[model samples]
Target: MIAERLSLQLPHTKVDPRILSALVCGSALALLALKWTRQRRLQQKLEEARRKREHALMEMRTMSLQFKEQNPSVQLEAILSLPLTELVEKLREGSLSPESVLYTYMGKALEVTHEVNCLTDFLPECVAQLQDLKKQKQRGPLYSVPISIKEHYDYKGHNSSCGLAYFLGTLAQEDSVVVQVLKKQGAIPFVKTNVPQSMFNFDCSNPIFGQTLNPHNHKKTPGGSSGGEGALIGGGGAILGFGSDIAGSIRVPSSFCGICGIKPTEGRLSLCGISSPVYGIKSVHPAIGPMARDVDSLALCMKALLCDHMFHLDPTVPPIPFRDEVYCSTEPLRIGYYDTDGFTLLPPCMKRAVQETKKLLEKAGHTLIPFNPLRMEYVVGELFLKGLFPEGASALLEKFEGDLIDPNLKPQLSVYKLPQLLKRILAFFLRPVVPRIAGELKALCGIGSAKNLWKQHAAAEVYCQEFIAEWKKLRLDVVLCPVMGPAFNLGYLGKLVASGTYTVLYNILNFPAGVVPVTNVTEKDEEELRHYKGHYNDHWDKLIKKAAAGGVGLPVGVQCVALPWQEELCLRFMKEVETLTREKSRSTIGPRIEAL
Candidate 1:
């Protein structure tokens, strides 16, 4: 009774004024310190890079003057024009010397690097390496052959910076497995090419190296993360270039630049000593492959790499040697064709390119059966994206560590920065407007828990099984599909992220795929695309048409895909498609080939 009458009282507490002030000030100072350190290091590396470029440019000018005084037994034009296969033959037969070949390539590379800004690191020790090769008798398929590599591949003395300022000064202790194999085969990687900041964007630009312009048109992008490789090969600077593709990194540039590139099924090639922002992530693993002007050159590259040498170097890769018989087969093939994936309807130029190829293939006696589109929405929204950012995209952005991100990457970078409430509001509004893309963004724009990641893996396995079942039911030998094309204009990749459906599908399926040039963009294609309408709204409809404007003469290509580990067959089909496309373009009359 007495306690009730008194009533209960509680004391109010407060932190000491000095302690609160100290905690706030301490955090502010630490943040400022970290940011300042990052800025200083970034500036130093960039300055070093600038100095190096100036020196290299000076050397190039001197080299050009000297070339005029020397005599090349093979005409300079003819020597520079030869393919990898021919280059090797000439070198071995004594018709071409390593010095002459190297000099010719060096001169062209200098011209190209200036034009497209494609090279990141020119081989500084190349002169010494050349002298060693000259002194020591060399014997291999690629003896004295000049190769260009993507920036990520390891070289013993040089940094494989991969467009990251943080990795700038750290030299690799040893060469990558692929690089060792190339050297073993006597291929000389004279330079490394540029990539996007994260090695993720399709448009190639970074704070450290600036942007890589398209060789076809400076206004358009060359395409990436293999953008520089595409530009170098397309410009005739390098006969063959090495690049990696997890999601059209190899094929997009190949298609955009009017060249050939292949993304082999995962585990078919070694990936040791390669630098990446995300390591130990296999959900959608990046694969190293060759990019070249012609399919035969790519075949030669694969033939050289898929050997006993690399297998022994990286025991994780299966000891699978190149099968020449598969590539040389003459049997009539059962080929399936699809003009549109229904996920991202390719532009008229792309579809037309595919149609022309289908016509040629039909005339060649290969049965071109119609193949329906598979479950592509799941591939893009659920399987691929979830596997890629299973912990959510937040962790991926942590890679930058408050360093500068590329301007061209802002659209993608913005997605990760969006608050959950904001994303939901945007998604809700976009659902009725750009429904497809709305769903794609929502699925891809966050971190994932362990349970969600498990679900993603399970879904991918299920999708792969379903796709294989469809392939088996069709009894198809090879499938001809349209690659995401014609290349987008500069600065459009973020808006068209969903357009990569065609290329990324094969990657998710782990299918061996190749991109082959079929035709150039035409006035008709541009006109047809102008009137084209989508199931969605003007956001993409207007953007898509605008990207195709002024795109005449840009390269358009088709994708050829086969089951996993069927790379030999995939290349064989590519070779056939390439031959037919050439013949068709040469003569308006259909080109007849000996029955497959």
Candidate 2:
């Protein structure tokens, strides 16, 4: 019976070689032509957008020159030197005209962008907006203050390209809720800054707008997707700007740029009209916040933005206004401090930033308690990496289909784009060699079923509860920790994304977090970094160690975190850190402080 069955097997069918060759060649040629067409189309879109931006900038420059020529008495240097508070005070008192301030910042922005390439579009409509503001009898909180916004915020008549060629010509029909509030508060949205492609990568670069160089060191990234705002603000082009954060988009850039920024609890501020590639990922909700040169500026921005206008425009946001009392309170409270998240070890500069911040806070009479982040490796994998792309990275990968990939986003994208089964097999084999990478690989495979996605979200909630229980057990008012860097080399994050573990923890917990610059990388810090090794003796760790070199004099900052809905308290902590850093800088007691 076996012999009969074997004998019954059909012979394999064969095709003519000539026909097969023709089919293969035809398919290959068609694919090449398709790819070439896409590239050409992308270039056309990119060139058109660049031309529009260039035209806008030229108009702005002409207006700026006319303003300077018209207002011969206006002191551009003095006006630019003023902080947000003083600037607003001058504007309110009629000492500084809105146009003068606007033109001053526009000129400064032009100068800064020449070096850093941080700006996307110069809003010439700001001149018209200034006229509108002049008609208002009463001054608003941010009256006549020029502000730059991250490019993804929807502004009527402008494209929120988000550094992608596909979105280059798609204009917003109306202003974002936040932009509406800014206009209502008398702030001039003079220019929009650049962002990473899809606004996902931490290193700011995209094919259309190019890369934003750090104002401090050209070789280092300014941090993204708020990197343009960071570079602009840090370079003193704009006093206060707005940037959104999911996983350190705001705070990391602020930290790297030696500035201040806050990521309020999700839903605390309106996110309506923000263009997002990950529009509906509820597992890790992105928050909109202010990035400024100082904590006070951030507070002022928050105060102005969290108004009835924002609440009315986006009812999904919590209606609670900014709490002045919480921000101004002088209460001495318990604070938790940690240098390492345990998943990825910080470079010496980052560790020193946290250590020095702890000492300064303790000296200021705030009680400091030691707190260790629990299961951070697990949180990073299951809660963050998995939660972000629960349906799998296919959707995100698709966003980059026809666009040129930023170098910094390519490594992670390559891994995420791998076949699900192949990823799992790779993860299993690398478990012993690079446990963290393996875990991330496994998590990135994603839960293919709805039931599994639900379970994963459930696991995230449980983890947050456990983490909060620990916080409650300690009775901590705030947690002080290192923000991710001393501005790594421009393309560093592409190789080692786990560096984001520091900030992703708070995002997972949905806690309010702020970053305040405390110190500059010291020579001693660089020496210590030479011997640095991460938890794994793997490629990622080696890359991190290599990227941390030559970081001396770069700005370092620490993060201050508070419980959900405690943005006011978080800002208060940031202010305290800023205050202490200033005093310490004056006395030269610790590592060199670089205060904004």
Candidate 3:
């Protein structure tokens, strides 16, 4: 007040206007200089982080290669070639030593890591732990069995960076709940795999760890946010690996990489200590589960995790043990299936993959009924997208406050960066011109207010209940549907952002969904897809067709969905699909795993 009064009073005796102008200009320049210095300092810190990350990465990569090089032709085949189920059985029967299993998988995983940049942290501590476990007289189910983990699983002393440069330096003080359960059951977690920056995008890439590519074909993405685990398991390096799914993080990778993944309903497996960007926002809670080469492997890993040990570790998880009866049931089921998700149309390969599976299920004596895709425009546009960013994406954006952004996240950020006024204008104008992209952009804008966010939350529950009621009305036991497919070529995610509607729907519904590979993309499927127009013939369909082009021999997969908490039944259905796929392939009845 005194300063204001003095300035106003002194206005009658003002200094030279030129001098005042110069002073004002000087102040502005100083502020700019201050900002410039802060940015420079930030750049220096980032440079230091880069050097440290590069050094550690090179050392780890070299060490991984050395493990491969040091492997003698002795017993690595027995270690690497056996499926996870067989590996565990053999280990239980004393067919393999703990050290040998660790060494063999370590060597093979390192080889895959070198090719795909998958493993985020190679834990030598795993070896020490294994050696210690070897002395125990009593063994657990996963005794001497090697398992891989998604990078988000915290292991004491290692950072769960999840591809973010900012999270690179902070070390975890304790193991995550999943890690504890795995260790208690005697599973050796030797390596943690890479994920997208912030674990948000479907393509796994970051400045710290780079991108993870498909092991089957290096030209295509492995699918993410669990891309590293998908790459590891798909490449035949890890027997069973753990990953988390919000949308299709686990299943998309499984579909893309020709593996199996299970997304148990929320609270089935504990997420305690698991690193996630959207940790507490639970409208679509991220569920942690297992990914593997086959359905049995998935079940085995799930059984190990969904035990009393897990409940003890995190009391939040319901004390529900794995249900053997549901998994072991042999009775035929009534299944509902669809080729397209209604939001994003399936390409020919994807449609064919589902069609083939539907036929196989029918032939296997399971009744198959056509299920229309539900209200995906609202499910995706209003419920899921709004639910995720209901707070206008502040939680999601805070991680990038001063960090280097990944190219994979660039397109998503564009939507997040748009002004509310601009979004409204675009929404109105694009509603008729390009409704699909408009809805997507509008969804990405996030819910602007708490009232709107609450509506979205209530809307999600209502939608889930409505979906369940529909399922009951139709008497559908399980749903077999096309997963978003063809293992997209790298750099196409920006255009194909909506391609994941197939997987995201289940997340919103909180369904227990598992993915299984049905067939590889054939020349015919690819050719047909090139000229393909989807059911709706919308903009998304056109974009999908473009993305699916040249995807020949890339794997196509179908998602097996059951009601929430029905993971065991979901796995059982996935097993049936796997069994029927094998039988059909043997009889030359339909699409084979290898199109060639």
Candidate 4:
């Protein structure tokens, strides 16, 4: 009886197949509708942001025109032509008022932005800031000087979106520590400039603000992620601006735009309130520095920024103030110079710029020693890439999810987003063909475990030690080298990101480095560029050659580097190079290239 009861089965009822099909179709429709709604909302936000920016620009232009009409004696051209130092002098001596300088720069910036699309948002709060500054009895070093900043720097009540639609509506609750220090020093930040999405790529383009073109040649990129600051200064719209660097952000832009910019030692200024693309990476640190038309302007900004106020506002920053003696010293330096890093070959113009600068400095009584960077490919792979993103591209890619990706970033993102197994296979096959890229690909494929991440970071520390030991052995006060560009064509960085080794090497060492415009690309430089097949003769090398074409008359710059916490000395080196370059251009007989 128990077995018979256990074997008993229940009767089943059947449902309509048509009902099941209808339910499935309805569920698919619901999902499609949800996706459409989300995309529509994002599009509306993007349009709204564009409208806001345009409106702000219109208001600024209108205000500037009214000021111009009201003050006919303000000579906009003459004032705009003055360098930062002269402008500051005029302001101090009461020959020019703060309002005139502000209006002049605002009008000029508007003109430049129209041509280059560099600016994102004009600061209306500038009027209030100027009013406040007028009440101060003791004027700051940058008194009444208008400055532009990279978009990610926090300004109280403004958005600091790093060119992503996801972050459009968020407002910065307080000023970035650097901004706070600038305000105290009487520098008015009148505009925020555009940046590449996530501030990851070296070329400046984003879905929200669009692309920022090189002012000198619209077909070329001005270099990024500090590109806007470079364009603004390079175009004579602003005398000085602030930009931050992690890799080659500041110096590359400076090189491409023919402006001067410095990347200070990590934490030399302040990073508090700047919206970094990736956080919690301990291997490399991002730094804040100034960009300007002339080296003196950069030095002046540094002097103002490295003050008690900056130290007080950000306790994490080293409290050392700018040393006047170090910047102003007349002492000759033991300068080490290199044209290439051995991983990637620089264009002929870039190499010539380095060689020429070395000759100039040597003539000025500084000793020039040849220096070769050690294991640059390894440093870029393990230290720069893996060290900066130990967990891989997930952190950066997640930021762009649901947001429109810039075309310039797609190639780079695709490389990092490959499947782990696929990445290994590609690396294995690519090792002999393009070893540099293979090494980088292997590093970018996320560290599989915490133990591996720790090992990578330790390796970075060891590499730094080796680099420092080499530097000490050379006994060099400064190093002179080629900066990565005379500006490449737009969108090429997606395929040639590793070309930044010339500048990234310094960032990895956390050294203070500056870029000074040394010369303009000559016709011969472009002619020689045709033969540039890099060491590997790979696809990347061909891409670099193509990117560098049509760059004649573009400005070329070189890097000046010093040890950590030696920002003052770095600036001095840059200033020396700038002065010598100017004198060479003015002389009937230029410095002979083959004299050395």
- What lDDT does each candidate get? 0.83, 0.88, 0.83, 0.90
Ranking by TM-score: 4, 2, 3, 1
Q: Model 3, residue 342: what's the lDDT?
A: 62
**Cα error, candidate 2, residue 342 (Å):** 1.1
Model 2 stretches with alpha carbons more than 4 Å out: 1-31, 589-596
**Per-model TM against the reference:** 0.91, 0.94, 0.92, 0.96
Please state the error at residue 233 of candidate 3 in Å.
1.3
Q: lDDT by residue for model 3 over 246-337, one digit each (tens)? A: 98999999999999999999999988889877666757867888999899988888888888888988999999888999999999999998
Model 3, position 398, has a per-residue lDDT of 85
Worst lDDT run of 10 residues, candidate 1, spans 3-12
Q: Score residue 549 of candidate 4 by CA lDDT.
A: 94
Best by TM-score: 4
- The digit string of per-residue lDDT tens for model 4 on 308-356 reads 8988888888889889899999999999989988888988999999998
Cα RMSD, model 1:
5.5
Model 1 clashing-pair count: 6
Q: Judged by lDDT, which candidate is best?
A: 4
